[model samples]
Target: MTVKLTNIRIITCHGEEVIEKGEVLFNEKGILDVGQRVNTDEHEIQEIDGSGLTVLPGLIDSHVHLGMDSSPDPFANMKNEGPEDIAFKAVQQGYRFLQSGITSVRNLGTRYNVDISYRNAVSVGTVVGPRVFAAGSPIVMTGGHGHVMAIEADGCDEVRKAARSQIKAGADLLKVMATGGVLTEGNDPGATQFSEEELRCICQEANKASKTTAAHTIGTDGIKNAIRAGVTTIEHAYLLDEEAVELMLKKGTFLVPTLLAPRLILDKPGAVPEYMIDKVRKIIADHKISFQLAHQAGVPIAAGTDAGTPFNTPGLLSDELALMVEYGMTNHEAIYSATLGAAKAIQKETEIGSIENGKAADLIVVSGNPLENIRCLDSLVYVFSKGAIVHHAPVNKQEKQEQIV
Candidate 1:
């Protein structure tokens, strides 16, 4: 199917200039052309009138867990649920994300490869959802954070073997638990879980398999170790010290702060554990400072909400953008973090990050200008993924009449 979206304002991160009145042409396979205007009447394409809307590349969420729920004991819930049940829930989450104008998502962790199965299903047209880069299961040390749902391995040799196993299982990326987490009980959030040598070995194995590694590190030491070991992205560097931040900037590592994950806990105190609530309350106070430091130090920051965590919804990633703006990021920078920066973090920049001529036809049309008010992202009227419209907000009859007249 061919589609022509005309009379739209296009925002591309490649240049400072914006196309005030532009058109995008796409077929079923991918985007065919994008310019200020294109000859479309001869092509027998379905023309979509975009009179007053702004069109941008589809949003990407760099960190997500597709098959997990935010229960009081999320790991215990995962253990009890069968794979079939998990797969169904994952598909549901994927669809929800698509509806919210997110064309692609990187699943940071999942139970038993359920996210991988869901990704395959979406690729094969068996399901209707956003594009997914799945990490089958995160590698963690024995009794470490996320160990309940992760593959537990000890030492460098075991870590290397475990990482290779994930690659063989069709993981797009390898996730490693490099430090203790807030959600997991009986673990210190400030402690490191994987040794520096073990992290290096895991990265080496992942590189051999041509897979990227994302380290889930929160504490200062773990953050430094993950950066030194060459992990592509740091999931949550909540307790990053000056040394760690400097190393990250020097190494050009991408940081997906996942600010919403901790902020959610603080905002809705009743949703998470009391201990986590208190921990997050303290962390939230300092998170903005850390983010500002990372920004000032030239560290690449991407927006990731850590969706599927307690109080974090799949379709509401715009909240993360709002938080980014709160942390000294301009509206345009925050939007770019969710789009281009996120794609770069996940290594999918060539395919779906921008509204380019040869990229996938993954775009969103919002009713208002997002540049003026970032929250206008929530006013999505149309969303397209791979040239397919997955979500279309119904236009009010009165508004339709006004447009017609």
Candidate 2:
């Protein structure tokens, strides 16, 4: 059905320009146009009076784990969760994100290739959720970071096989653990897990299959090694030093900073793993600082929340943009990171990032101007996914009359 959203303010991330009295014209296929006073027949069109709302390209989360649920005590859940249980929970989480206005996401890890299956389900209309690009499983050394969730493979040959397994399982990209993680049993978050040669081999294998790689690295050395090995994106460079920052700038690698991950684990008033608490305390300060270094050096910073991790809510990726603004980015820059910058990170820039006429009409309407206040994203008034009005916030009694013109 054709629809026209009129009398709204549009923040087009194409160049961070704002259009007054903007109209978004769309149909089942995609967006038809976005501009001021778009000429359309009012009689047949479903006209939405968005006089008090602001429109933006639906937010994109470049890094998230859908299979895990992000309650306060996620350690127990991840430790004992079964595949069927995780799958069921993921279905709920995916829709929750959609209702919360996240239109696209990248799942970096999951148990039993569930992420790939979820993505496929969304594609085939068996399930309804946002677009998902998944890494079926991550590659980790035996007894290293995320050993439980990842495929354990050591050495060059084993690493290559691991990469192939994720690709074979239908991963859009390959995720490799370049360093040990804090939450894993008997692992040090500050130590490197994979050798440079093994990391390079995995990248080579992924490249041969025409897939990109995301490195889960926390230590400075591990971040450097992953950059030298030519990984496509670096996740959680919490301890990035000046040298590591220099390498990222040199390689032109984008950093997917899930800043909310550690903060959530550290601040939650519940029983977290002792190791996790300690790790967050030790690294939280530097984690905040690393984003500054990358932002200052002009390294592309994309908005991602390690959702499904301990206390990192799935639909709360918008909150990360607020944090990004607080940390150093302007409101427009923060919004751009989650929209266009994230699109570029996933190599979908030509398709889903901007408000182009031919692009998919995955967009959201907030209660206020997000370009003025980033937190406005948390108050999404409407969510239009692929030209369908999937969600609309409840209107107050006083505001109901506004819907009738």
Candidate 3:
């Protein structure tokens, strides 16, 4: 069915521009037309009055672990649950992402190929969720960070095999653990795990299959090593030095700054493990500083919350974008980070990044302009995924009166 949204403000993330009083026409397949004026047949057309609404491409979360629930001590919780149980809970969480106006998500790491299955389920119309790009499972050093849900590999040859295994399992990308992490026992967040040689082998394997690699890196040394090894995007990156920033800029590597992950751990200290809290407290300041340095240095930054970690709930793209603004980015830049910037990080820019002709109709209609106040995203009125209305909320009379007055 054809649908047209008329008389709306369009935040086309194509650049720093907005189309006022524009129209967008789309069907289940893709976007047909979009501009200040769209020519469409009146016959059998479903028109939605978009007055007082701002329409933009839905958010893309570049880093997430769907199999891990965002509970205190999620690793312990996962030990108790089976794969079937995890998949069921992940499906519900997927819906939560759609409700938050996230249309595309990249599952950087998950156990049991749960994300790959979810991706297939969404593709075949068996479930309703955001477009999924699954890594199947991350390749980690033996007893490295997130090894519970990752493939443990050692040396260059082992990492190469692990990368191929994920790709063979239908992974869209390869997730490699470049350093230790906060949640894992006996792991120091700044300690490098994968050597540069091992990282290069993983990246080469992914490149052979035309897939990108996202490296979970925190320490400055590991960050630079990953960049030198051709890793596509660096996640966390809590400890970036000038050299690391320059390397990323020179290499054209993207940064998936998951500021929300550590912040949330600090916010609810008692709710999470004490060890996790300690780790975050040590790195919180450095994390923010790294993000600011990278942003100021013109390193490509993509918005990712690192959801499914301790207290970092899924479907919180807006919160991450808002934090990006607080750090140093302009509102336009933050929104782009989550939309087109993130799409580029995951290599989906041509498919679902912005409001353009022939692109997937993954959009959201919010009550206020996000470019002005990103918190306005909280008032989402409609969420469209692939031209299908997945979520809708009626505009009450009081809200409409305030808009008019």
Predicted model with the maximum lDDT: 3
lDDT of 2 by residue, 174-255 (tens): 9999998867756789899999899999999888988888999999999999999999899999888888888888988899
Task: Point to the candidate with the largest TM-score.
Answer: 3
Per-residue lDDT tens digits of candidate 3, residues 1-405? 788999999999998779998999998889999998999755888899888889999989988888789998887887677789889977988999999999889998888889999999999999988899999878999999988888999998788888888889999999998999998988998998999999999999999999999999988888988999999999989999999999998999999989988888888868888999888888889999999999999999888888898877878888998899888788899989989999999888899889999999999998867777788887889999999999999887579556434
Measured on C-alpha atoms, candidate 3 has an lDDT of 0.89
For every candidate in turn, the CA RMSD to the true structure comes to: 2.3, 2.6, 1.3
Q: Clashing pairs in model 1?
A: none
Better of 2 and 3 by lDDT: 3
Give lDDT tens digits, candidate 1, residues 184-229.
8777777898988999999998888778889998778888889999
TM-scores for the candidates: 0.95, 0.95, 0.98
What's the lDDT for candidate 2? Answer: 0.85
Candidate 1 ranges with C-alpha deviation above 4 Å: 40-42, 396-405
Error of 1 at 214 (Å): 0.8
